[model samples]
Target: MGKVKISAVSYTNTLPFIYGLQHSPVMDAISLSLDVPSTCAHKLIQGEADLGIVPVAALPIIPHAEIVSDYCLGATGAVNSVFIYSEKPIEAIKSLRLDGQSRTSNTLARILLRHYWKNETVSLVSGGAEAYVEIGDRTFGKQHAHPYVYDLSWHWQAFTGLPFAFAVWVANKPLESSFIQAFNDALAFGLDQRDALIAELPPRIDFDYRQYLMENIDYGYNEEKKQAVALFLSLMESLEDPKAAESLAKRDLPK
Candidate 1:
């Protein structure tokens, strides 16, 4: 068979997955292109790539999407990298800006504002809003920049009492079982080497890489997180219907 075309996130958070894919023998069987989270979703939706590590929000729209791996970009609480930064408190904020790199995080921020935070006055803007949702590496050390830095994943866990999976490895179509097992093995190897891999990355005095990777980022995909993904998707779908979201407002909350 021809090389399996893969679109993967090109962010610091995904470095380990990229590292694993490139360093292992599975690299020979696949063609990989690193892109922003939005582009990863687009490629898979358009059938430009066979598989990708995509935001959970995109799963409902991507045709024939299937979570094919046992790992994901996830967090149980206080993921330092995804936040809503505001000089004003979340309730007092009237408008918000969104990050350009990720669809899931922006959507996550909106979900929180509407459901968990109970602040519906916030208007999304392209520039100079009172608050903005930023994700990935750009959010590092940014907590101090704003008086109120709301951690979205932390909020998700607080509200749902479940771990949040931001992105998961998904295939547009089913693949051979052997290839899936090989891919899983390669990912495991990369995760095992995170300590060594992190040592090679440029150090940042502002952010604690060890704490963020080991504690904040929950890389495993288990049954509980899967349920979170399902509920998250349900809430995401509800955004199109206010009556449904009103019920969600009653139950869902944030930390």
Candidate 2:
């Protein structure tokens, strides 16, 4: 068979997984493409890729995709990356816009605004002269510090009382049980070398990048984390098509 075509996010949090794939024994087994979160989802949905580390919000769009591994791009508390920069407090905002970079973070922002902040008129956008939602490293520097920022992960925590995972590894086709097992093993090795992963980070970021990776991120795909992933999907189901959401709810989720 030809190599499996895969898509992954070109974000800092995803570096370790990308690093793992680049150095893995299975590197030649997959053809990888790197894109932003929204593009990653689009690639999988368009059949350009067989697997993706996609934004969780895009889960409902895929027909039979299953989370293929026990690792995720997540945050236990404030992510320090995803941010909502507004002229007014979150509760006072009349209009909200998305950064056009991520599908999952965009949805997570809305979920927090709707359920946590009690706002009703949120909208998604690429950019605005007034206010906007931005994710990833571009959100740092002067823009991130100046606005009345709301970290979606922190907001989700305050509202749902569960850790938040924004992106997950999903496969469009069901793998043999053996392939799934191998994927998980690779993920474990990737996470174990997080220190080495941080060493390869680009120099644009000014923070204690290594410490942030160790402390803020949680990559476990254990039962508890799976439950949290289910919770996110359940909540997303309410906002999206209920019929499709119900079908997804019945499927065996990642663990």
- Candidate topping TM-score: 1
TM-score of 2: 0.86
lDDT of each: 0.88, 0.76
- Residue 103, candidate 1: Cα error in Å is 1.6
Q: Which segments of candidate 1 are over 4 A away from where they belong?
A: 246-255
Candidate 1 lDDT, 1-255, residue by residue in tens: 789999998877887888888899999999999998989999999999998999998998899999999999999888889999898989889999998888888888888887778898888889888888888888888889978989999988887799899999999988999999999998888888889888988999999888887788889999999999988887887788878767766864444
- For every candidate, C-alpha RMSD to the true structure in Å: 1.9, 4.5
* Candidate 2 whole-model C-alpha lDDT, 0 to 1: 0.76
- Candidate with top lDDT is 1
Q: How far is candidate 1 from the true structure (C-alpha RMSD, Å)?
A: 1.9
- Pairs with backbone N, CA or C atoms under 3 Å apart (clashes), candidate 2: 98-125
- Per-candidate TM equals 0.94, 0.86
